[model samples]
Target chain A: MLDAFSRAVVSADASTAPIGDLSALKAFVASGNRRLDAVNAIASNASCMVSDAIAGMICENQGLIQAGGNCYPNRRMAACLRDGEIVLRYVSYALLAGDASVLDDRCLNGLKETYAALGVPATSTVRAVQIMKAQAAAHIQDDPSEARAGARLRKMGSPVVNDRCASLVAEASSYFDRVISALG
Target chain B: MKSVVTTVIAAADAAGRFPSTSDLESVQGSLQRAAARMEAAEKLSGNLDNVAKEAYDACIAKYPYLNNAGEANSSETFKTKCMRDVKHYLRLISYSLVVGGTGPLDEWGIAGQREVYRALNLPTGPYVAALSFARNRGCAPRDMSAQALTEYNALVDYVINSLS
Candidate 1:
């Protein structure tokens, strides 16, 4: 049950270690990373875990943005867009590492929607959003017009806009707030 | 302003708890939930950015008789700029969390939370637990529902008073 804060206290406790092993945390962090990677290996599929973790952090911030009123539109959009990138990048890394279960379908959709809002080019960016959209769109669009596959292609190939981005931001905010209030 | 102050005070009075990775995970989970809800709120019949936006917009749009105003700007250039940045930093935390990664997400959580305190003209001390609580709940004192928020609000008051 040694939480991060308690570990800090335990390390700082003069009675226990004489000199605090501040560097111990670095090792602990490395271990945590390994554990995370191991967990991914066991899961086999990229679990939405990382995305879920980061998603919560984003929601907390969005509530504050809404509170600040609409003064910094450019920064606001930029901030949301940037966050979207971070989440997308993290998901990409997890996926590349062979953890497909790290993100759920809806969240995967979120990544796609967010990247689309940024007007990101499909083949250029290393972002998972770009890769997924490009590959998926090409696969879907190749199907015949009257076929059900084409309809599915149309659903997946649609452009995502800033409005959707805003909606995501708002959703993350509410979800985070409620979870926090309930977790205690 | 009153609700904010009240919440801050209530938070300040709560017994502090050392944070753990689980706490961080819990914090992260809660925030993600909040983000999802925020998106849903945006899609709802009414356009509200959580409870505050609902209140702010309602007070602004339908209430034609009311005047919505911002904080007064200082006459001194340096002071004004500093104040603005401080508030921006606070707002940035909220926005960054909501939108995604903030530029300063690299800062450790406690330090990052402390940055908010500094911006708010509060002193930094051994209030990691308190700060965590505040962040987990957000800065809106009125929006708080649980006992943690009450205690967190008290802690905020104590910190603010201790500094002043």
Candidate 2:
């Protein structure tokens, strides 16, 4: 699995190969690294933004106006934020490590805690996570290179690395879903 | 305060049942008054040693079932339990008022539950599950059994009576 992941990552890296000048190739790699750093920053904070957006949507739908006529999430929204943070961290770890197996039983238990805290069934929790992902995706969509950078980060955290990290994270999520269902 | 209590009682009597969407305006009025009274009491009695005792006595007086409930021995404990139960009941009521209908309360999708949480100005995390549990247990007045329904009404009335 690691060999195939490595080859895939190497192939993806090769696709961005610079022609002619070695200095140009170095510059291209340097630029990609900068974009990757930006992507990481966005990814790290995406969960909080998603949680806040979800809370805003809820507050708007329910007409929960605060003293200032502005709606804000209460403590419960904090729980959702916590859950999102956990998922994002674990998924990012899995991607960076290029091994979903790193998310073991302990990790699954943590996921369960989020599901329980969110007070929704596993399926509903999954839907909520999907919504978060969509929100995150939308936020970066306007910047095509940044979006590509994010996509690259998912597949491989750095352009220099050669591992299908994104696929591992996807598998990790599926594994999480199975475990959650089994827990039920 | 007395007028608010009177209004809630009158509405309960007129409906011949616990308050529902049919008399939502009255229900909302009672809810707002109850909330106001709680806030006032909390503010006026701030840091007072006997505040919990007073709240306990008031709650037990209105809903005797709250009295002698095992393990709620101290005034503070009793007060805490009473407030928790009251909040739970009130959230359900708020959910019904905002969401309407008695059609499988637990089945409210993410959007639906969000609406309920938002309507109550509640936090959106564990409380969502808590609300889901209440809905699953048929906490809506119409969904309750005869005895359960009576107890629910008594609980709401107790809040109105205590606050007023």
Candidate 3:
């Protein structure tokens, strides 16, 4: 599953703007003009959950936040969390666009930089993504409306969009792995 | 060759206290060139020798911290230790490229290098050998030669550059 996503991500064009480019990403998301209130809310909630989890990690393991002695002080931690939020927003937008290409090299590089700054390992990020997927699944299970809405959004595009979303989520892990590997 | 040696020396000097990414890049570039030259020398002369060791020795000499004087125990020089690690990483880059074909160097930290080597489908022997070589002074009489250090310089450059 991850291998396929890795191939897609690596093969994707590298020209797209970074996920940190909030203004541009906002404009892109807004241009779709499609009311994905439920879907958007789910993504937002998942992102918030991950952010909170990271905060918990920070509080519990302050000493561990040192990448080769480059500690993530409070200010740096805050900035990293902010970047993580932006990454989630970008992920949501990419999911909506049904194009994994939306998460380009710039976006991945931004993610790598943020992770490095936070001194967070790839395994931790993978766990966070898992939490996100679990939360999203639970949310959909509890509210059939969100599932319906997601399906409607998928119907607007080819089934490939759905595949893209799955691939995007899978790619998230692989991307972090690559970043961590490169950091070494 | 002399120009690259000068560039590396200058970069090391400029990176007095802290070596940023750019500083490391410059140093790595020179090391790669030196490694390439050493590899070429080995291939042409058909003699197994520490061709790149001269460049490595020069780099160590310029950076006093890299001198193996039991200073690895001092916490005050962690940054210096890191610089030494980077040098080892450069050498590992050359070794992996020429002999291992695809393993990460020790500069990525031991865990990082281990993970990468595991992922690369390489036997544990080469990774262990490289780690041992990086830490110790004498060369092992293994199938691989110090010349591999010179051979893989270009490969390291490609790998590092492609990361970003």
lDDT of each: 0.32, 0.38, 0.39
> Which candidate, 2 or 3, would have the higher lDDT against the true structure?
3
**Considering every candidate listed, which one attains the maximal lDDT?**
3
Restricted to chain B, the TM-score per model reads: 0.27, 0.26, 0.28
**Docking band of candidate 1:** incorrect
Ranking under lDDT, best-scoring first? Answer: 3, 2, 1
**Candidate 1 error regions (>4 Å):** A1-184, B1-75, B99-141, B144-164
Question: Which tens-of-lDDT digit does each residue in A34-124 have in candidate 1?
Answer: 3232222212222232333234444444432344422135675455445444444333322221222223332343544554676533222
i-RMS of candidate 2: 30.1
Native interface contact recovery, all models: 0.00, 0.00, 0.00
Q: Which digits, one per residue and each the tens of the lDDT, describe model 2 over residues A85-152?
A: 55544443333222343334325556666556745445444555555444444332322246545754
What would you estimate as the lDDT of candidate 1? 0.32
Model with the higher lDDT, candidate 1 or 3: 3
Q: Model 2 residue B112 lDDT?
A: 59
Look at candidate 2 and tell me the lDDT of residue A115: 51
Global CA lDDT computed for model 3: 0.39
lDDT of 3 by residue, A1-184 (tens): 1111122222321321111112332232232222132234345365455576565555555654775322256676675566555445444433333333334443564655666675666555554454455444433233324554575332223222333344333434443343335334
